[model samples]
Target: MPYLSPADIRSKTFRRKRQGYDPGQVNEFLLIIADALAGRLRLNPDHIRTVRFAAVPNGYDPLSVDGVLHLLEFQVRNGIVPPTGLNSGEDLRARKLPRSGTGYDRAEVDAFIARAAANLDGRGSMTSTEVRNTRFSTTSGLLGKGYQVQAVDTLLDDLEQELRFRGR
Candidate 1:
């Protein structure tokens, strides 16, 4: 299941509001919108499971698209199959992502680490608005909340550590 459906997102029904639109009708409409969007997105029954299992959850952030994509790319690069049901031709095609079964070069891995570090370091020195607008994309939703670059970098660090421990 998706984390939240479009209807759940767009629904007008919410906490009670004084002098607000009709709660019942708005909420119902949101649900409809969400369902329609969900259908269009082709969200699978296992989408939530896939995301949740991709990483151990922390209090602030859930696994994000970038994180998941990173993990998937890492797995592919290292020739390690992730510990979940992400292997399918349809899903791969749906994302329109390419996989040539080639691993990252040692130089590329080093460069990736350097880039992640630079991104994290720059975030520490930048203003909130700059970080929010230039660093993280809104497309990530809740996953794109505060300090997304840091989150992704931290995840990359963990992944790299795991890869090293595994003797990748």
Candidate 2:
């Protein structure tokens, strides 16, 4: 959704999760965003950057979606259109996995996010080119289930696609 525009925000359909965002509240906010986009006005970019939410039962972590919104706002303000997911960059959201869970290893996943951020932000040596070809092995630990391999691989594929799009 980082690629969503103001108009896109207006037209986009958000699914109602049984326990996702408060539909009313999120929809209201989207309207504000769309209006601001239409008016060429910058709203609370700083607020969006720093905002956090209290998790509700069944409500998705608003941050997951907000992060994309923040990115979109930043790009719009800077007058740059971030290419679609297929274009450029290796950015990802990191999630912590329990030491004993059916999730990717917390350490490895975090490390990957760090690397992706660095590469995308140009703070590391790995070029976007390298990221496109990079691959990771599933983790091995004395205890706990690692993040599902398929899930992590899928994410990597997405990250790679982003990088490839950017590289192109």
Candidate achieving the largest lDDT: 2
Which segments of model 2 are wrong by more than 4 Å?
14-19, 52-63, 80-168
Clashing pairs in 1: 1-45, 6-34, 7-30, 7-34, 11-30, 12-26, 13-27
On residues 1-168, what C-alpha lDDT tens digit does candidate 1 reach at each position? 223322124422233333333444434433433333323222332332333222222221222333333433333333442221212223212321121223222333344444434433332232222322232222223331223333333333233332332333
How would you encode candidate 2's per-residue C-alpha lDDT over 34-74 as one tens digit per residue? 54543334676565565444444565446556665676567
TM-score: model 2 vs. ground truth: 0.36
Q: Rate the local accuracy (lDDT) of all candidates.
A: 0.31, 0.53
RMSD values for the candidates in order, in angstroms, are 18.7, 12.3
Which candidate comes out best when scored by TM-score?
A: 2
Query: Candidates' TM-scores?
Result: 0.20, 0.36
